[model samples]
Target: MSAPMPTGVHYHQRSRELALTYDINGESQSFRLGAEMLRVYSPSAEVRGHSPEQAVLQTGMKYVGLKNITPVGNYALKLHFDDGHDSGLYTYAYLWEMIENRELWWDDYLHELKKANASREPLGIPLQRQ
Candidate 1:
């Protein structure tokens, strides 16, 4: 079984780069989010809504990056993607969870790409603007 993530993380300002403090766990991690990465990993319904089969393929996000990280509360973070996406609020625990399982998550992403028979070349979120 995987080890449980330590419950301690505080999101700081939304700067070009982000620095987080995990007090209880005595661990800290800093990550520079690329705009393309944010867009592809968006948690919005546009990227993850409807059904698994209906999941839209994301492409052309290599140039996309994170512009800012807005704190929604003590528990969540609203990422402002360079592509102008600012909807998904990654919870503190959620981010930690992702970090803890980065490899698995990355594998899943690759699997998604293969399932869709797509490439990693910057793809836009499949949702259309109304």
Candidate 2:
């Protein structure tokens, strides 16, 4: 089954989040999705690969930012990240899945990072962008 279509999809540059709003049962629900989450969990073949075993683990994406978002027909949106990743076509259902399972997925991602001795920080430093 398809997820409820979003009424609004707006990116907040200052906060680095994609604000998705939907109307369900006459109630308004909004989700603030971080750019880093989108990048690390990208649906592109480069990231997800063709099989589960071939999936690539993304690290150092804590500070990733969205460069652009383009609507793909009416079913999906193409997200372009600042790191030159723009292949993922985020479908409405998939985006909803992210919203519903963020905590679980995040915990799993952190576990994977830890197992690999990976850090979200690049060069172990937090670089401020002006």
lDDT of every predicted structure (CA atoms): 0.58, 0.91
Mind giving the per-residue lDDT tens digits that candidate 2 earns over 90-121?
99999999999999998999999999999777
lDDT computed for candidate 2: 0.91
C-alpha TM-score for every candidate:
0.65, 0.93
For model 1, the run of ten residues with the poorest summed lDDT: 8-17
Q: What are the root-mean-square deviations of the candidates from the true structure over C-alphas?
A: 6.6, 1.5
Question: What would the per-residue lDDT of candidate 1 be over residues 1-130, giving only the tens digit for each residue?
Answer: 3333333333232333344444445555454333444466667777867677655768655445556666675667788776677877776666666656666766787787888788876455553322
Which candidate tops lDDT? 2
How many residue pairs clash in all the candidates, one count each?
A: 13, 0
Q: Report the error of model 1 at residue 44, Å.
A: 1.4
* Winning model by TM-score: 2
